[model samples]
Target chain A: MRAEPQSFDRVLSSMCTEPHPAAREAAERFLATNPGDPGTYPTVADLEDDAVSLLGEIAGLDEPAGYVASGGTEANVQAVRIARERAENGRPTVVLPESAHFSFQKAADLLDVELRVVPTTDDGRADLEAVRACVNEDTAAVVGVAGSTEYGRVDPIPELGEIADSVDALLHVDAAWGGFVLPFTDYEWHFGHAPVDTMAIDPHKMGQAAVPAGGLLARSSDLLDELAVETPYLESTSQATLTGTRSGAGVASAVAAIEELWPDGYRDQYVRSQNNAKWLASKLESRGYDVVEPALPLVAASVPTPLFEALRDEGWRLSRTGDGELRVVCMPHVTRDGLESFVADVDRLETRVGLEVAGASE
Target chain B: MRAEPQSFDRVLSSMCTEPHPAAREAAERFLATNPGDPGTYPTVADLEDDAVSLLGEIAGLDEPAGYVASGGTEANVQAVRIARERAENGRPTVVLPESAHFSFQKAADLLDVELRVVPTTDDGRADLEAVRACVNEDTAAVVGVAGSTEYGRVDPIPELGEIADSVDALLHVDAAWGGFVLPFTDYEWHFGHAPVDTMAIDPHKMGQAAVPAGGLLARSSDLLDELAVETPYLESTSQATLTGTRSGAGVASAVAAIEELWPDGYRDQYVRSQNNAKWLASKLESRGYDVVEPALPLVAASVPTPLFEALRDEGWRLSRTGDGELRVVCMPHVTRDGLESFVADVDRLETRVGLEVAGASE
Candidate 1:
């Protein structure tokens, strides 16, 4: 006997969203290309340059020095590594909000840098006072989150930047989820408005590109140049990337996705997803669920563990927050109809629970 | 008017070989799949498992614990990180041969591990006496290269393994290029013959898979478990990868390539490439070039700087050795006809140089 192979289409419960149709098409078109060793394939390298330029424009940098990395983890790791190298302090430390992505922890461990995790406020945003208190003379970087993983709350970046400046620490913004959508929204969380020295942004998350299309942008080339290491065996003189022999398919797809969505295409899609999130939140709230007001496309609500398990068994994919709240992210593949059907199922479960309580009381 | 995008097929001078047709087909089949966040797509994750299993079998490891990483650099970094964590020493150091890949330099920098680079012998293999002298109680890992980047030389892995065992330090084998070719040859570099604790292998190299298909295999699951980190917001509890939200295309392509070339397919291809390399080496030697006998499929030869530049001008893509020798890697795409044409051009240039010298003397 053999087990049935899992289907790609059946994944509905992932926070890492699916690639857009155009992104998929782009990846398929460049399946044979590799951008890692750039000597043979200059085209993919050019595409990476274009993608990085477009990402810099979106993030409000004039001319950024960056590359399309593997994902947010690599980008964040690179950002921290740059800070560690640039800092003159003997003991390097990085300050981060409690809501920062787990990649920071990984970076802290891998780079052997001290991590000072500050708690978030009641509203699920980074505490500005806590960040200020955490920074010291040895602080290398102060990390702020935009579109946090659990609640999707943007940190107070302008204030954090000021705190970092007081101690001469580099400010790095983790905008892996917000870099795509926030540019079109009313939110002020880009490098243009904030004093961010470096940033980690992911086109795969909200730009609707294929998976693994993440970028680490530096305000100046000098910061990135500090990380370059010589490669004597290859044609290239030096490489600054954390990984060698990367796939160019991600860069190609990201370029194609950005070209299709640039100027206004992504804005329209964001508007749709944002509206869907708000609509879903309202539907849940009306049914007696405590829903968090969405800053982006994610909505968090409290639910029993049994209900969560039931939902999973029903083939509806979902995630949970650190405080044990159910999280629903409204990506392009998650439609309004799908949310409505999910709401109906929740309503039925609530009604059954109410009847069971009534019978027990009798 | 806009500039025309460069064609992917036009690249000819890259050591990064083109993807196999079967690998391309597999990638196209799962363009919309992501194996990292597996709740939504389980098939790609299963494909990753299958690919790792196949790689383990090729590396002579049974039921190896590992994942398909982004590339050789990531795999090497992860291996070093694991060694660093598992070591009980207060100050950790990694010893490597001078011919080891540049990724070790990166891992040492990223992980803050002390690197001891021992010089190689005249024949381009690691000097075991120097390596033994470098190892100490603080040494966490002793690295051996199966196929060096520039010279295609294999280090004495069995001897290195014995030295590592005596010191209780982990022995990691970097077989990124040789893992696919050496198994088919008479080389004793795999886990079956050598006492390797961990190994870094790349399917994108000679396995004919797409780029980004690098694997880090461990002798025991305990060593790999040390590198796992928890992701609170994700569906899975913890992730062992260096990059978060990686692409499944690499894993799928690797699996497809392995299935297509299993048992005897890769062996036949290796023999053909080996013959091609030997023929090219003879041709270069006949033309008065000091060519090194290829241990694998790479031919490194001394050529005049002017002639090397002229070959590049004629659109012949090649690499350079550390000692300024020309390197020609006979990959699957670099056919006998291609090598013959390259040799003819070199022959023409040599005749022209001889005539110029004669004219000057007259």
Candidate 2:
């Protein structure tokens, strides 16, 4: 038998929330349309164009040339491919901070580009000095994370952009998790940074769109055109995307979600989500957990692995950082009551451990 | 405003029918689930595994190592990546017929693999003599198409397999549009042909699953393992896929669609669709259009560009061959009445064009 629809109320580590009702309806509305082969259905092509333009606006680009990819991985891979193609040097390399997502490694492996990993600072942000030392004439792109996957800390993109300019390398900001929220916040993570050339943003993550709604935005259409390959068989003259025959439902849902959340709805949700993360961090700190103050809506706390496993066993969905830190992402679906109940469980576990220690000491 | 749900009843150029109702329900049922990062929801992962296994069975594999990809592009790309990695040569090259899907070109661009395109025969089948001449010690893979996208012709996969074996090169069959039908047909396009190492099959094309449901099947688990990259930040230990954070809806929908169509449903639909294509081909030929007899459900015919454009302008969706042949794909949603009405319109256009020509001659 197939599984039932999962309840989103208890999900803590996920950047994705339950899709907005409008988004789900939009997906259902276009479930049969394949946007990749658009000649069969021109209406879907129009919706995809509108969706891409709207996402470009959200990323702070006036006229972005990009498409909604399968997810951040495909988007980032495409960004790296563009950088590789545009690089003047024979040996192409990409410089990324240690805090960058693993998709860069995947891209490096797939595209035969050299990947230079620079260490991040103690605060979990990309270290600018380290980046400068790593970048060279052969560097095709410099990658910065808008929201680091584990810690949810936005890298200093403005400084990274300046560093990229010195090397004449494209700056690709991976704003997959924070793209929807950072736009409404006072963060310098978008294309407003002068040297930013491309970005991978996912509406499915924080825009509350249905899944598989990731966009890759480029500052110039010329950069995107460099990746196009001739398709002699299809209606479209050329195809530049990483995937063939992509679903139109993702594009339609993203457009619907953005339309419903634009101007104020997203800002309101961001404020609430940020507040929830702040509240949860304080509660965990008070209970003796060494919490990392969230820059976005994700809070990472130093917790015992046994206790982490115990919490997971207790039906609470959570994730752990690479260094074994427990993380909780405050999405719109995660309610205050749910966090409180999780805190209550942590308190009980603490009490049980304390009693066991006391008995062993006696 | 968003485009309204398209009426698929009149769509003739698409191999995709309106998604099976069960497929749509399954997608909606798993809209909130993310199988890519499955630590939070294990059930969706199970569904994905089951879906992959079922698709492998359809591809004539008792035990296959694979995953559900975003579409044929990702699956074919993954197959090429596998071949490149496994090849013992320093310079890897893939040999494919000119009629292969455009995704191979995209893969060649992304993976830096030299793609050698051998010209097809007049009947739209891969030329065995040309393929034999192309294969060498440096050839990493030889690709054959189960169903040519433009002409709906099945390449001689059994002969292609023999050629690949002679060179010790991996043989990959791109059955994206034919996998669901060829098993029921007496076509030897699957793993039963021993030298076939990998296959890219799309459920969305002929399985009637919702969009974005494609699978990549490999003969051995070791081949699939070669693509795995360590993802330190996500729930999954290693990431082999082209995309991260993929939606579970595709997997669930595929599984549900397969379950609903298994045993006899697909075979019944296949017979009906094949009959429809044959009937359409006969009608087009009787009307003096040079029709290519379809091996699958696609019917390609030589129509004047003016008539083709007029048909499109009149809201009849269609695709064309690279050499400018008008094509009609008879999918499940296409009815007898729809084809009859389309033929009537074609007859009318022919008379109008004939009158214009006579008047010009006068």
Candidate 3:
């Protein structure tokens, strides 16, 4: 017999969440269709176009061109690969802040491009001066993290675009986690805001879609055309997706979720989630723990290692950041009750073990 | 609103079929889970282990070290990437036959590796001599096609293994579409057959799992370790997959399908599909059209273009090979009744428009 799937009640660190009802129904309906071969499955293919159109609207692009990638990793990797191909020069290099997601490292390894890591500001934003100093003629692309993994900080995308333009390099915004909520904020991190070449936004992350529903949006058609290869099999004449036979589950789910909740629904969700994150942050701070500001519905707190482990022992699905901080991602599934329960466990555990006596822990 | 999904009633060319009942149920249950972050979704991760174990048992491997890929494309690409990493040489090259899938081209482009394309024999199998001539000290890998896309031909695996051995290169067998059936046939195309270092066999294709259940089996754990990247986010310390945040749908479905059908159930399926392919091939031959012998459950026939268009107009979802032959893949969903309908349409079309009078149309 197969094992049961994990429950989402205690999951606090995962970027993924329980899919919406419409998304789940649509995913189940089209689970067997292959979106890679558009000719063979034109219905799902059209739905993919719908998903991209919605993503384009969300990212402030009038004429968006891209495909549904496997996930953020594939989208980010393809973005760097496109920049490298466009460079058409000597050994290419990619410049990014130290706070960039690890998937960029995967991209550098896959594309054989050199990586020039720049330091981030004290508040976790990309250090613009450091990025400017690192980017040279060899730089094929400069990355700006709209929603960093640990700190949830939005880098200066327009300034990074200027730096990339100085070297004729592309500006790829890693907005995989922030695209959904940044629109509700005053942050300038999209196509209309700057000279953005491409963006990685995932419906699976904050858009309440099923897993694998990752969006890669390009400002110009030429950027996507470079990825095309001859696909002389079915009705389609060419293919650009990394995988040959992609399931329609993610595509249909993205379309369903976007159709059900575009501007208004997502805005409400962002407000609720941001409030929950702030609530949890204040609660942690009140309990004598240092907490990062809840910038975008993600909280990072410095809890004693023993208390963190004790909470884990109490069945809280928790995780730690690269920097010894307890990370909490307020996905749609994470409710106020869940956070309250987590805090209650932390307080109970702290009382049982003398916190001052234990001191700092790993 | 999203477009409705296409029906499988007329799909004759797709490598994927309607997912098995057990597989679909499991996939729906785990649709929101992310197998890429196994530290959080341990249940589905365990199922992934179950799927890989079943794949190893079928591939004649004692211990398997691999993961569920997005599809045959990711699996094949990773196999080449592993070989290239192990090469530790400058500008590593990959030697493959003309019959290899186009996904290899994607891999070559992504990994910055040179590709030496060798020709195939008249029988559609890889020319052993051509492969031997192309492989050299710089060759990182020699590919053997267990099942060519255009033809149901299994290349000479053991001979290709010897040629790959001469250069101390890795041998990767692309059994993506053939792995499930080759076990029932007398084809030496597994870890036990030759010095096979890795294999690409998709559970989504012939194993009746949902799309994206591609498998990569390695002879040793070192091959997979070469692809690992530090994933200091969730519970798992490292991840080897090409994509991050992969859906657990594929892993759970692969495990469920394998549990339902391993040796006997798959053997029965191969017998039925192979018989269907032979029946269709003879029917086309009897109707006075040239047909390629169905070595497996795939049939290729030389059909005139106008009639092919007419058949398509009648809503018979079809495709052609790179060599312009009508390609019919007898997947588990392709019924004998469907083949009879297709044959009837072909005969009626030929009679309405004289075949010789057209003088062969494109």
Candidate 4:
């Protein structure tokens, strides 16, 4: 019922809270066994390899090729940086869908590159025509969104890959939200299948992991060469991340999360989340609400404006996207019963939005 | 024995294996909460005001001024970015002690600023004269190391402040390893009396909090104007940090750690760490090991090159500095007996390095 932090303190605290246990344990363990960096006890290298093995299991990547990063934003930013560095230098431009995450924009801004947005179809899929048109000799990379921030839709990755190949540009998939989920979903074959040159995954999201925890996995080892900054204290090996001194706790937690889920457990969890989402969508539509269907477990509904405020007053939290559509991200924790309660609450508030759903529904 | 992970895997399973019950409970409580873009449901404003009120019972700031970051590296980076942004366009350079944390160099490199290193005195503290010689009109910021990474030496902050004032540059203190310790030690007054404009504090390091946790406290709220970035999804508030999508779990854990560790509790922790450090230093010194003295909870020792390798062969882990000095960072969990064993092992390895006691003949 209270207001959120509009300032820096609120944002920072929020970020820190997600990985508290993992980070705390990491710090305590590091202090307990290897109190100082001066010692040769379980070095960060051992931790790195351990994390890589665990992540490899989760993503189903064969060679354990990847690096840890602070967050999805940094991972995305690093991918952009790598692409720019590999650019021919005369012109550098990154092509991304209009529905791509804001981090793509941030990365382009940080690297001082031009950002070209490709239009998306009405169903929230990438417009392949627009994407092909956007690519040229100056194109450094093409970013396709898996689970876009606006519509929670997965772009046609294989089609985009072909487009990128035609232009001789890198294909980066901003899979921050859906990277771990796709591995367990019906679309398991879609991931890393279409020659996604680089992908960013956040364990904190549907991976059900901690925060400040995300990674970028590249198919080619050469991708990391662009970000390699050799230094005395922080050295870059074949495997390197965007920033140094990352929360080992985050990495450890991610490793643990993946180990717990392994192969079958995680796949089952995604199925449950998807089922829950489908059920919620069906119930909402039956109640006469305009629900976006075949949704990627993310439901964006359009109801009368007044009813939205009524639901908020009833203690239900829903986010509105840029086009004034309310969105609900079906997290792993969102339960079936909880969905029912949410639907019922919406039904009650429907009258306020000038809807007569009980008898005149659908 | 198999190495334990940095901490319990909070993502995979909602389980707790931490030794401290309070910390474990705090972690669980934090995981249950989530913040939205404005960050998690309770909102960061509410959490910050709550944390400020809770910690205010300890060393409460007069005004609500400060930003939370992920550990000392990020805190230092953010502070450096602030200084650089506020500097005259053509004159953006940072000067710090040679003994400062490698993170400073990283921050400068990432921000694309010139870094000038000032030599340290024999006492391991920053040389004020060297600092003055290095600073000129082009210098954007002067960084003072409190509990430097290599030698764990505290710079003369007050004296360094004078040099920064002369150069008309901002003075930033990297107190990541010692911030929590200083507040409760004999140096309590030093922090309040120092002329530092900004400081990086790591709750995870000396505060014994979780990892990926840190704070950047500046003397004035006006200093934060530089780290601002404007985007459609994220609005840069007065206290925004480096990245977005912060995890609320981390913030709650830090707040809990700070609130739980009252002044007296922190004082006890500091005393214990310092005692362990003193005992180790004294034992090493008696063995005629080339040891740096007057170090806080962190002590550095130099062994003959061969002896260092011999100790590594024996499975003792230690950190080496740029100059090949091995460091020991005593913490909450280190025991007196363990310190004695470490010293004895080092003494044995000294013979392997072909270094005999100077007064062996006597």
For candidate 1 chain A, the 10 contiguous residues with the lowest summed lDDT are A1-10
lDDT of 2: 0.87
Candidate 4 positional error at A72, Å: 1.4
Candidate 1 vs. true structure, TM-score: 0.95
After TM-score superposition, the amount by which residue B119's alpha carbon in candidate 4 deviates from its true location, in angstroms, is: 2.9
What value does DockQ give for candidate 2? Answer: 0.74
Q: State the lDDT at B261 in candidate 4.
A: 73
Off by over 4 Å in 3: A355-362, B355-362
Q: Write the per-residue lDDT of candidate 3 for residues B265-319, one digit (tens) a residue.
A: 8899999999999999999999878999988899999998878888888888899
A170-200 per-residue lDDT for model 3 (tens digits): 9999999898889999999999999999999
List model 2 lDDT by residue over A1-362, tens digit each: 45785687667878777889999999888888888878877788888899889988888888888998888888899999999999998779999988888888899989999999988899999888989998989999999899889998888899989999998999999998889889777779988655689999998888888888888899999999978998775678988888888878888899999999975888999898999999999999998889999999999999887688778888888888889899999988988899889899999977776677688999
lDDT, candidate 1, A210-246, per-residue tens: 7668888999989898778888856778888888887
Tens-digit per-residue lDDT, A1-362, candidate 4:
12222222112112122332444355334422211121222354466466655665555566645676666777787888778778886558999888887676556544557899988898888899999887998898988888776567888888888898888888888777776667755553233467677777777665555655677777767776666653342212222444444554455566656656656766786687678778877887787778887456677767666676676566555556566666666776566776777777776667545554444655
Candidate ordering by lDDT (highest first): 3, 2, 1, 4
Cα deviation of A198 in candidate 4 (Å)? 2.0
Q: Answer with 1 or 2, whichever has the higher lDDT.
A: 2
The collision pairs in model 3 are none
On residues B229-265, what C-alpha lDDT tens digit does candidate 4 reach at each position? Answer: 5433322222246665554545565666677775777
Task: Give the TM-score of chain B in candidate 3.
Answer: 0.97
**TM-scores of all models?**
0.95, 0.98, 0.98, 0.83
Number of the predicted model whose lDDT against the real structure is largest = 3
**Model 3 residue A61 CA deviation in Å:** 0.4
Candidate 1 Cα deviation (angstroms), residue B309: 1.3
